[model samples]
Target: MNNQIKLSKEKREDMIALIKAYFLKERDEELGDLASGFFLDFITENLAADFYNQGVWDAYTYMNVKIEDLLEIQKY
Candidate 1:
């Protein structure tokens, strides 16, 4: 069992940046190829093992969080 480790704001921001960079990089690439290589190159990569080691398996958990934040956005 893994104990939950608290992340500093800076650390959390860094992890978010890492995720964005990864997605942006793959955005222009072939989805099929990237999907096939994702398991090893992204999933098992050092960033995964070091930070997001738990893996984001809960789709709704992620989606709801995003939706909630988006809903809170104020349109000028």
Candidate 2:
């Protein structure tokens, strides 16, 4: 099973820019394109799954609540 998170080219560029911005603003250091890209790739490869799983869990909980409400509307 491939767990790697594949982002679109536009999204990847956006993320790289965001990472560079964060470093410049927060760390007072400028990150080059290669460094920012490597950072983004590392995050995508290593940390994205945790975030994705959390989103899935949140969606599941929300759906369960909606399903319960749906059952309450049934005529019996």
CA RMSD of each candidate after superposition: 15.5, 0.9
Task: For candidate 2, give the lDDT of residue 20.
Answer: 94
Query: Where is model 2 poorest over a 10-residue stretch in terms of lDDT?
Result: 40-49
Model 2 lDDT per residue over 1-76, tens place: 8888888999989988999999999999999999999998888888889999999999999999999999998887
- Runs off by more than 4 Å, candidate 2: none
lDDT of 1 by residue, 1-76 (tens): 6544555767655555565566669775333434444433544444554555345546658888999999888797
Per-candidate TM vs. native?
0.33, 0.93
Q: Spell out the clash pairs found in candidate 2.
A: none
Best by lDDT: 2
Residue 39 displacement (Å), model 2: 0.8
